[model samples]
Target: MMYDVLIAPFVEFEFMRRALAGVLTLALGGAPVGVFLMLRRMSLVGDAMAHAILPGAAIGFLLSGLNLIAMTVGGLIAGFTVAILAGLVARMTELKEDASLAAFYLFSLALGVTIVSIRGTNIDLLHVLFGNVLALDDQTLLAIAINATVTMIVLALIWRPLVMECVDPLFLRSVSRAGAPAHLAFLALVVINLVNGFHALGTLLAVGLMVLPAGIARFWARDISTMMMVAVAAAIVSGYAGLVLSFFTKVPPGPAIILVTAFVYLASLLFGPVSGLLRQMFPGRHLEA
Candidate 1:
């Protein structure tokens, strides 16, 4: 019965296998980036970036009608543009990145909606917004896998500077010339991951698999490494469980995966070993910090 519930879906359908693979690649890159975003308290900015990619994605959709390569490139261009513009605002002007991100994403969201309304039906717009994970092709899967690999490699290369920047940006800036580049590169990776994630999860909710696991991990883990691992593990579990549930229940796979992570977040919120709401019930029982 358990095998039928869990393994049968993937074994019975090629689409299920593709869906699982696609989300797995997304989680590989999304998890660590998510942990960092949470630690840096850039959750809102990250969310905005996800939404801000919509206009480019919409343009791609209009140009190619659900071509994965075109839409991904479009999303990448849009996401990176916003990140760079936001960073520039933070650097040159007095406006913060969060405010800049909010403004840009709102405009982009409006633009995307307008374009979609003018060019396509409401259902097409929904497909862009929510994605068609079951329709992922080999090319899309390969793109996601390549993005995940590149993200992991670049992260390893800049891990030290990133950690330093996160912990003590002023100190890192004073000590090494890598601080600014590290920050920019990290943002670039985020954009790339979001772009890839959009292919499976859509522009609006791509940040779900990324940010939610990180939030859940924060309550359970003390250090960054542990948090990242936990986040990835949680994300993978969510992907698997959500897929299984979706196969049986006929819910949308993308949002189901995200909902699984949401459930973990709720569990962590109330009963985590570290800083959970229920922790107060057992005073002085803090986990390793």
Candidate 2:
């Protein structure tokens, strides 16, 4: 009976299958973006953009009445718009990028909450924050698959130049067009993935999943490529484990999955065996030498 509750849902129900597929796609799409976000020092920017998607999603829900595609597109536009506006503001003012990001996300969160209060129920608000992954429909699953596939392809194509730009933007700028095209392309992919994953994980945990696994990978891995691979693997394992746990516990999958990933992150931080927190703190002890 315990196994039935834990594993049967995934094997037996269509909704569970869709939910798993959606999460797997999100994990893949987000892991690479997280690595790049870390490399570019734009991790907070991703968080802000995720929150910035909320108002647009609420508006889309009000206008179209639960049309997933329309809502996803609305959220994507809002997220990308905020990102671009923040960039412009950063260039125009003396404020740093982090400051600009904070402003954008705060504004977006306030606006989203206001709109949802006026137009939606408390459940709607909860959905925006935490999501309902077990209720994900076929349409959403299909969209997730498509978005993940395209995002992966685009990332593969531009990975080198984007990495170069992230590592040394000044040097790249001195060379040619400075990989601006690649940068733009990567940002576009980020928007798509954020929107695609929004309904499955919500803004708060979406950003968490995006950043934590990549961060954990950074502690144990030296090379960029290896770090990315490790991040993706970590994300996939944690996501699946979380989903299965949620199935058995009859809990909300989004937070459950995030908690699992968070545990993995904590483990990596505490005992990663290379530059883990314990090793760093002790300085004389070696977990694996």
Candidate 3:
């Protein structure tokens, strides 16, 4: 039963294997970014940025007509544009980060959709919104892997300063000038990962792989490093489970992966060690006394 359920799908079909590899690679690279975003209280930022990638992608479609490289570059540019603008808005105005992000996100989403609608067919737009993971080819796969590798390396180099910003921003500012640069660099990484992610999960769902796992890890792990590792593990597990479920149920792999991650997130919310509903249920016996 197990073999038929899990092993047979990959062994019997090359696309299944490729699909598994694509999502697993995505989770491995994107999960850590989600953790940091969660820690820094930028969960919504991922969503906003996801929408922000669309206009660039639409522009790419207009220019190259479904050329993968063009769309990716366009998406990267659009994502960064919105991210940088949000930062500038926060820095210069009375509005907070979330508020600035909200303003830009809505505008960017509407703009992107309008651009695509005016220039693209219904099928082309659908591709932009939902993505086609099973159709991911060798060139796209290589691009995703390369992007993931760069994201990890840059993140490691900036980890300390970035964590400082998350924990105690004022302290970081007082001690060093790296705070602003770190924030920008981190935002860049977020944008790049989201662009790469859009190829597999689409603009709307790409953030799930990053946000849900990190959110789930929050309840299970204490420190930042542990939380990141746990988040990656959870992402990989969910990705595999999601792919298997997709194989049997005929569900779309992207949404199936998200559904599995959603379940994991809900499970953590209910029974996690740190702040679960189950922990709340027996509060008297669970005290630190």
lDDT of 2 by residue, 1-289 (tens): 9767667877788888788777777888888889999988888778888888988887887787668977897898888888788888889999886788799889898988788778788988888778888888878888888888998899889877888887788888888683988988888887888887687887666686688889989878978889888998898888888888887786778988888988998899998867998888888855886
Clash count of each predicted structure: 0, 0, 0
Q: Which candidate is the best by TM-score?
A: 1
Summing lDDT over every window of 10 consecutive residues in candidate 3, give the lowest-scoring window.
Answer: 280-289
Per-residue lDDT tens digits for candidate 3, residues 1-289, read: 9899979998999888888788878887899999999998888888899988988988998888878899999999988888778878998989887888888888877887788888888987778887878788888889999998998999999999998988899999999999888888888989888988899988888899999999999999999999989999999999899989988898988899999999999999999988889988876564575
- Give the lDDT of residue 88 in candidate 3: 87
lDDT of each: 0.88, 0.83, 0.89
After superposition, which runs of candidate 2 have C-alpha atoms over 4 Å from their true positions? 1-6, 281-289
Candidate order by lDDT, decreasing, is 3, 1, 2
Residue clash pairs of candidate 2? none
For candidate 3, give the lDDT of residue 244.
90
Against the true structure, candidate 2 reaches a TM-score of: 0.92
